[model samples]
Target: MLKDRRILITGGAGFIGSNLAEYLKESNDLVVLDDFSLGKKENLSGLDVEIISASILDDSALNSIEDVDVVFHLAAVPGVQDSIERPLETSMTNFIGTVKILEMMRKKDIPSIIFASSCAVYGNTEKVPVDESTCPEPLSPYASQKLASENMIKNYREIYGIKGISARFFNVYGPKQDPNSEYSAVIPKFIRRCIEEKSPVIYGDGKQTRDFVYVKDLVRALSLIAEKLPDEHVFNIGSGVETSINELAETIINETGCGKEPEYREKRAGEVERSLADIGHIKGLGWKPEYSLKDGIKETIEWMRRSR
Candidate 1:
C-alpha cells in the first residue's frame, strides 16, 4: 500500500524480512541490507530489489545507504538460546546494530522506522495476554536487547523527532524459516521433525503456550504501520490465540500427515512458560491476523514439502 516510497529493510533476506520484502516490492522501491551471517541469499530469490551485502554494524555500510522513506530493522542474532550462549555477539548485533540503523536513519533524514521487536521482552508473566503497558521482565540477553532497542527508539523519537514504531512480535513461523539451525524456532523445528516422521522435541512439559502469528499476517501489520503511522509507538503483533506446544506439535503432525508424537526434554533456561498477545491495540487500527493456526500450519507444511 506504500506506493513510490524507497524503503530499507535491515536483515532483509531473513525469514520475516524477506516476506515483508515480497509483500511490499510491487509498489515500493526496496533495498535490502544483510550480512548473510544468519540470512540467506536464496531467500531473496524473486524479489527485484537492490541487495546490499554488508553488516549493520559496519559504519561505512550503514552510512553508504541513503534511505528515503522508512526502515524496517529486522537484522539481529535472533534466538534466545543464541543470546544466552553468545551474549557479546547478540548484544553487538541486536542492540548495537539497532543503534547503527537509527544513526543511519537520522543522518539520511528518514522520517519513519518500524522495528522488529520480540515478545521475549515480557519474559514469564502470570498474565495470559501481555500488552504493551505490561512491565518488561526480560529473562534472556536477547529479550534485554530488544527491550533496550525499544527504549532507544523511544528516546530517538523524543529527541530527534524520528517517527518510530516497535512491533513486538510473538511466535512467528512460516515458509523459509530454517529448521536445520540449532537456534531455529520451535514451529519450524517441529514441522521439520513431523515431515521426517521423527518425534518433535519439546523443551519443557509441552504445556507452555505461545501466540503464533503467521509471517504473512505480520508483514501486513508492518505495511499498515507504515501507512497509518499510528500515535502508539509500540504494538503487539500476534494471532491473539494462545496455543500450547503440545497442541502445536499435534497440529503440525496432523497437517504433515507424519503421525509422530512430541518427545519430552528438560526445560531449557530462559524459556517462558506462557505467552499471548493483547492485540486489541493493533486491531483498533483496523488490522488483525487473517490466518488461523491450522490453516497457517497447513500452508507451512505445503511449502516445506515443496521445498524438499
Candidate 2:
C-alpha cells in the first residue's frame, strides 16, 4: 500500500476510481476530483477521502490540489458509441482534458501519473493478442482521443520530465458499475439482467471477444504502478485470457440460474469486434490478475444482489 503520500484521482467517484480509492485511502491522503456527471456520490459512501466536485477541465479544481505525490488520470468521456455520437464533446474531455491535467502536473511539479487508457486504442487488430509493440489503429473518436492523450503524456514526460505511464485497460467490470447507465459495460448489465430474470442484450453476433480484467485486479495494477514507478511508460492491464460475449453471458446466466437467452441486436457503431490484451508488460512488474471470469462474475453478482 502507498503510505504517507498524497494522491489525486480525477474520476474517483465512479466504479473503478472508487474501488481504487478504497484500496489506497487507508494508507494515503487521497483526494477525488470529479464533476459527478457520470460518477455517483453514493459510490464513495463510507470512504474516508476528500472529494472535489469538479471536472478535470476546471482549472480552479486542478490548481486547488497541491503537494500530490501521484495523479491517477481516470476522468474521461467514456464509451465508443457515446463518443461516436458526440465526437466534439468527447475530444474536449478525453483529449483536451488530458492536456489540462498534464499542464497542471507540469505547474505543480508532480513527478508521476498513471493514466487509465483503454484497449479500444488497439482497434480491429489481426494479431491475436495486442502487446505494447503493436501499432495502434484507433477505430473511434474515443480511442483516437485516448491515443492522443498517450502521446501527449509521452511528450510531457520526454520534454518536462514528468513520469507518465499509460495503462491500456481491457473490459473492466465489477461492483459499483451502474447497469442502469446507457454506456455501462456488458458484465454488470448482464449480471443485473440475470438477477432480474431478464435476457441480457448482445450487440453484434455475440462472438466478439474481450479480455475481462476484474476491477480489484485492475486497481492492484494501478497501485503497483504508483508504488514501483516502472521504467516502461505503457502497460496492458488485463486478465490476458480471452472470452467471447456468448461465453461471458453463459457464465452469468449459470451463476444466477436465470436461463433467459441473450437477445441479439444490431451492432453498435465504433465498437471493436475482438479485444485481448498481452499483459506481459505489467506482469513483469510482479502483477497479475487474481480473479478468473467465473470468480469475478460471482463476486459481481453478489454485489449486485445486495445493492439492487
Candidate 3:
C-alpha cells in the first residue's frame, strides 16, 4: 500500500510482475516495461497504468522510466533450460539489460530498486539451507547472469548510495502462472494435470526438495521490503518449508481429489539435489510467509480450475 508513489516494474507483464502490479496498483502510480518475449500484455488487462512494450536494452524506452521513485527490476530471460539452450541471448538480455537499467537509474538518480535475483545463484551448493553468506557457484548461464546483475546492483548501491535490495526468490507459484511454458515450475504443471485427472510428471526420482513460496506471500513480503528499505539488501523469500517433488505431486493429487500416482522421469541437469533457503536475513526485515503450503496449494488449485 505505498501511496502516491511513482513506481516502475520492469517485467510487469510476467507472473510475479503482474502479481506485484495487482498488489500495488491501487495505491501507487505504476509504469511497466516489458518486451513481450516472455511476458504477455493480457497480464495487465485489468490494471490502469502505462505499459511500454519494449526491452530494457532500449535506452530510449528506459528514458521514459525517469521520475519514478522506485524500480522493481524483474525483467529477464527466466529458465535454466532456456539459458543453456541459448546462452548468448540469456547473457545479453539478463546481464546487459540490468546494466542498462543501472545506468538509467544513475542518470535518473532513482533512489531505490527491488531486484529479482534467484536461488539459482546458489547453484548446487554442497550445503543445506543456503544463506546470503554462501558463495554462489552458479551452474547455468541464467544463474551466472543473475549473479552478475546482483553484483552490479550491490556495487551501484555502495558507490552511489542508492538503496538496492536483491530478493532471491524460490519456486514461486499461484494464479496467472502459465503452465503451457516449457520452463514452467512443478506446482502449476502438477495442478494443471490434476485438474485434467492426469498423472503429474516427476523428474529425478521425485526426491528433489524445493522451497516453495506462494506468489501472494511473496508479493506481500516484497511490498514490505519496498516499504522497509532495509540495510540488509539481499534476502531469501521462501516458505521455510522444503517439499520434495514426489510429495508436492502427491499433495496436488490429494488436493484435487484425484487418486493417481505421479509419473517419474529422469533427473534434470543444472538443478540442485536439494534447495532450501536460510531466511534469517529476510526475517530481520519483519517479513514472513503468510500462507501455509496446504492453503497455498488449495488456492492454486482453485485458481487453476477457474482459469481453465
Candidate 4:
C-alpha cells in the first residue's frame, strides 16, 4: 500500500521500529529519527534508509519533516517498572515528546499518524482481555504517559485536523529485542538466560499472564493502520492469547534445549497481575497474528543464538 509514499518513523533503531522500517523500506520512502539512547544502530545496520540521529525531546530535531505522508510515533521510554523508578524522565519523553511531534506534524501538514501505545494503561483490571474501550487505570508513570499521549493525539485530531490512530500494543517480543538492557522485556531476557544455561528469574509466582505479540505481526498492523487511515481510531494489537511467565519460561527452555529451571523471586512493585488484548478491532481490519507463541519463541531463539 505504501508505494513510494514518504514515511517517517521515530525509534526506528529499536526492536519493533527496526522491523517496521524493514517492512516499509522495500516499497516506501523511509526516514528514521532516533536518539540512540535505548535503540542500537546495529539493529538498523543493513537497512537502506535515511537515519536521523536526534532526540524527540528536542522540538527542532523533530521539526525537520519534509513531505511526510505518515508519522509512526514509536519512540518513548518503554517499560512499566522503569517508569516507576524514573517518572519525570518517562513523562518528559513519552507525553511531552509526543506533543512536540504532533505540533511539528501539524505544521508540516502530515496526513496521518499511527501512535504506538501500550496495554499497561489498563493496569491490573478484572477484565481478562482488555480492549480499546476499557477505561485506563494506569499503574505506573509509563502507562500514564502513554495514555496521555493517546489523549493528545485525539485532541489534536479534533482541534488541529490531524488524523491519527492509537494502537495499544500488548507484550511485544521477537528478534533484535535488546536482552542486555536493564528494561528488557520478559521474553528476550528469559531466552538469553536460557541460551547461557542460566536459570531464568521470574518475579512473584510466575503465574501473571500477558499477551505476547511477535514483532512481525505488529509491523503488519502498523502498516495496515497507515494504509487504512481510520478516522481518529484505536485498536489493540496482540496474539489474543494469554501466557504466564512460568509457561513462557517453559516454552523458551523447551525451544532452546536449555536444561535449567526458572527461579522465582519477590514480585516487583507496580506489576500487573495479568494482561491480554481483545484484538477483534484489528482483526476486523483483515490483520491477524500469524506467529503463535511457540513459533515466535523458536524464531527468537534462533535469532538470539545467531547474535551470540
Candidate 5:
C-alpha cells in the first residue's frame, strides 16, 4: 500500500534520509526537499531523484511542494553538541521547523507523517532499556525540542486526524554518514579516525553506553511502521543491545586495524551515561534489526575505506 504513493523525505540528502530515499524510490514516487545545511548533495548522486533545495521552515518552500501522500520529517539541526552551541538555531530548525511541517501537512491534507524523533529525549534516565512508558527527561535543548515536536505531532493526530508517528532513533550509523561533520556520531567519527590511523577520541571515562542501530535496519523499520500505521504514535528504534564507548572504540580499532590507543577528553555536557531501548513495540509492528554492531561496523568501515 505504501508503494506508488508520493512520498516527501525532508532532509533527503542526509545520511538517513538519503538511504531511505534510495530504498523507497524504486517502489514509491520519492521527492526530496533539503536545505543542504547538514545534508550532502553527493549522497543523492546516481539516483533519479526530484530535488527541492530548501528548508522545511521555508513556508514558501514547503508550500511549493504538493501532492504528497506521506512525509518523513528528517530536517533538523542535528546533534547534542551542536545544539549546545546554537540553541536558537536548533530550536528554530528542530522545533519551529516541525511546526511548519505539521501546518503544511494540515493545509495539504496529507493524512500521515513519520517524524524523526530521538532517544536523546530519554536523557540520563537510569533505566537501561527505557520504553515509551518512561517519562522523557530531556537534558539538552535538542532533546527538548524533539520531545516538544512529538507532543505537537501527537496532538495533531488526536485533534486533526493526522496519522503522525514519532520515531525516536538511537545511535544510527551507515555508509553515507559524514565523519567530518563537527557533530558527527561516535560510530562514524570513530570509524573515520580509525581509518586514518588516528587515535579515536573518547569523551570522559568512555564507559557511557549507547544502543547503536544500523541505518539499513532503521530504514526497514520505518518502512514497516509506515505500512501498519500502528495504534501508538511513539516507538524506540534500535538494537536492544548496548555497547560502551570504550568497548565501541576497541571494536572499531580491531575492525579497522587502526591505532590501538584512544585519547580521552571531558565528556560533553548533557550526554547520557547509558541508553538502551526496549524494541517490543517496534517489533510488534513486524520489524527487527538485521545488522549486529560487529557486522554493521565492518560494513561501515569497508564503505569508509573505499570512499576515502
Candidate 6:
C-alpha cells in the first residue's frame, strides 16, 4: 500500500520509529526527522532515506518536508519517571511539539497522520482492558501531555478536515530499544542488567502488570493505519496480554540464561498498577499482533546479548 508514496516519520531513529522506517523504506519514499537526543542515529544506519538531523520542537524541521502523504508522528519524551523529573521538557516536546506538527500539516495541507499515542493516558483505570471509549485520566505529566496531544490531533481533524488516526500503543519492546539509557523501558533495562551479570532492579513488588507489544507488530499496525486512514479514528495497538513485572523478569532471566534475580526497590510515584488494551477497533480493521510476550522477549534478549 505504501509503494511510491512520500512519507515523513518524526523520531524515525528511535526504536519504534526506526522499525517503521526500515519496513516502509523498501516501498515508500522516506524522510526521517530526528535530533538524535534520545533516538540514536545508529538505529537508521543502514536505511536508505533522507535523514534530517533536527528536532520536532524546531519549526524549520517541520517546514523542510513538503508534499508528504503520511506523517507518522512518534516524536516525544517517553516515560513516566522521566516525565516526573522533567515535566516542563516533557510537556514542551510531547504537547507543544505535536501542536507544531499539526500547524505545519495544516499549512501544507497534509492529507493524513498516524499519531503514536500511549496507554498511559488511561492512567489507573477501573477498566482492565482500555479501549478508545475509556475516559482518559492521565496520572503523570507524561501521560497528560500525550493525552493533550491526542486532543490536539482530534481538534485539527475536526476543524481543519485533516484526516488522522491515533494509535494508543501499549508497552512496546524489541531490538534497538536503548538499553544503556537510564530512561530505558523495563524489559530492556532488565535484560541489560542480566546480561552484565548485575542484579536487575524492580520497583515495588514487581506486581505491576503491563501489555508488552513487539516493535515489529507496532510497525505493522502503523503501516496499516497509514495505508487505510479511517476518518478521525483511534485504535488501541496491543497484544491484549498482560504480564506482571515479576513474570517479565523471570521470563527474561530464563531466556538470557543468566539465572539472576531482580533486586527489589520502592515503587516510584505515579506508576500505573496495571495496563492492557482492548484492541477490538484495530482488529475490526483486519489487523492483529503476531508476537507473543515470550517470543518477543526471546528476540529482545538475543539482541541484547549480541549488542554486548
Q: Estimate each model's TM-score.
A: 0.97, 0.97, 0.97, 0.97, 0.96, 0.96
Local lDDT at 248 for model 2: 96
Give one digit per residue, the lDDT tens place, for model 2 in 210-277.
99999999999999998998888999998999999999999999999997999999987746777889
lDDT of 4 by residue, 189-285 (tens): 9998999899999999999998999999899989988898876378999999999999999999899899998998999876778888999999988
lDDT of 3 by residue, 12-69 (tens): 9999999999999999999999998889888899899799999999989988775899
lDDT of 5 by residue, 69-170 (tens): 999999888887788888998899999999899999999999899999999898888877999999998988999999999999999999999999999999
Best-performing candidate as measured by lDDT? 2
Residue pairs with colliding backbones in model 4 are: none
- lDDT of all the models against the reference? 0.91, 0.92, 0.89, 0.90, 0.91, 0.88
- Evaluated at residue 111, the lDDT of candidate 2 is 95
lDDT of 6 at 121: 83
- Look at candidate 6 and tell me the lDDT of residue 70: 82
- Minimum summed lDDT over a 10-residue window in model 1 is located at 59-68
lDDT (C-alpha) at residue 233 in model 5: 92
**Positional deviation of 87 in candidate 6, in angstroms?**
2.6
lDDT of 1 by residue, 1-308 (tens): 67789999999999999999999999999999999998899899978999999999998888788757989999998988888899998899999999988888888899999999989888888887999999989989999999999999999999999999999999999999998887888888888888888989998899989999999999999999999998899999999999999999889888888867788999977567889999999999899899999998988989988898
Per-residue lDDT for 1-308 in model 6, tens only? Answer: 56789999999998899999999999999999888888988888888989989989888777888889889999888877889899998899899999998999999989888899998888889879888898898888988998888888889888998887889999899999998787788889898888887878999999999999999998988888888787647889999998999999998888888877889999988678888999889887788889988899988888877877
lDDT for 150 (candidate 3): 92
Candidate 1 Cα outliers beyond 4 Å, as residue runs: none
Q: Candidate 6's error at 110, in angstroms?
A: 0.9
